[model samples]
Target: MTDNRTDPPFVADEGPMLHSWLDWQRETLAVKCARLSQDQLRLRSAEPSTMSLLGLVRHMTDVERYWFRNVLTGENTPGIYWTDRHPDGEFDLVDTASAEEAFARWQAEIANARELSSGLPLDLVGKGLRGGEEVSLRWILIHMTNEYARHNGHADLIRERIDGATGE
Candidate 1:
């Protein structure tokens, strides 16, 4: 699969820098999952671990929705793959999951997140609560970039285990 990920600018303002890094991380995850079959995507890192490429995609979908829609925009949207009964459903429920659907939802959520935050200043406060305090869009962007970077590390290992493929 074509990785088409763009490098972040060497010098940029805060918003552009944050979005660029986040976009790079998102594309890195996509590259890790590229050209893999649905069954392969469902392959766990090891026994007793539910992590997988598909699971990561699903988890990020919910993460995007939580921070951008539910928290930032106060959209009252439910999670895409998580619930009270299955908090880890994103990872645990991938046995028969459709990779196409998962990717589509994830991409859609990414677009929505961009739309929701496009006009708002980075310093603008969000409705989302974290540790009993409201957060800012800038904080959410940084947090999400960090989130994807951390998860992409796991994705690197899993992808290599799946096919001996490795790289940034």
Candidate 2:
């Protein structure tokens, strides 16, 4: 893997610190998916489990849109790979999903989300709610960091199972 992740700074202001950690988490996922074929990317972890590197990429695409576009900006944007009828399509319907498209969308969503929240105060409350409570940019950043961290673990396991490749 062409790992380009930088260790987050140990001393920094709150905003840059959080963004660095989130970016590190994002890059970790990319590294996990690197240098794998489409079929390899789509390989599920185990029986009855829909999780895969490709699915995680697709799922994170929607997740970025959901948190940044919908919740942060109140755009009401729909899922790129899912709908009301197929909520898990991002994971479950990846038998023929395009790794190219999924990665592109995921990167685009990440870029757009970063742009949308750029220079915004961490204390700024979003236009949407979570659990009937308004969420701040700080909360979203932390949540996204945690979200990616969790799924990146799954990605690590799946990648390991794919070709015995493993690392942070």
Which portions of model 1 show Cα errors greater than 4 Å? none
- The lDDT of each candidate is 0.92, 0.94
Q: Write the per-residue lDDT of candidate 1 for residues 60-100, one digit (tens) a residue.
A: 99999999987787677888898999999999999999999
After the best TM-score superposition of candidate 1, give how far the Cα of residue 73 lies from its true spot, in angstroms. 1.2
Consecutive 10-residue window with the lowest summed lDDT within model 2: 128-137
Deviating ranges (above 4 Å) for candidate 2: none
Maximum-TM-score candidate:
2
RMSD, each candidate, Å? 1.1, 0.8
Instruction: Report the lDDT of model 2 for residue 34.
Output: 95
* lDDT of prediction 2: 0.94
Model 2 Cα lDDT, one tens digit per residue, 31-149: 99999999999999998999999999999999999999988888888898898999899999999999999999899999999999989999999998877889899999999999999
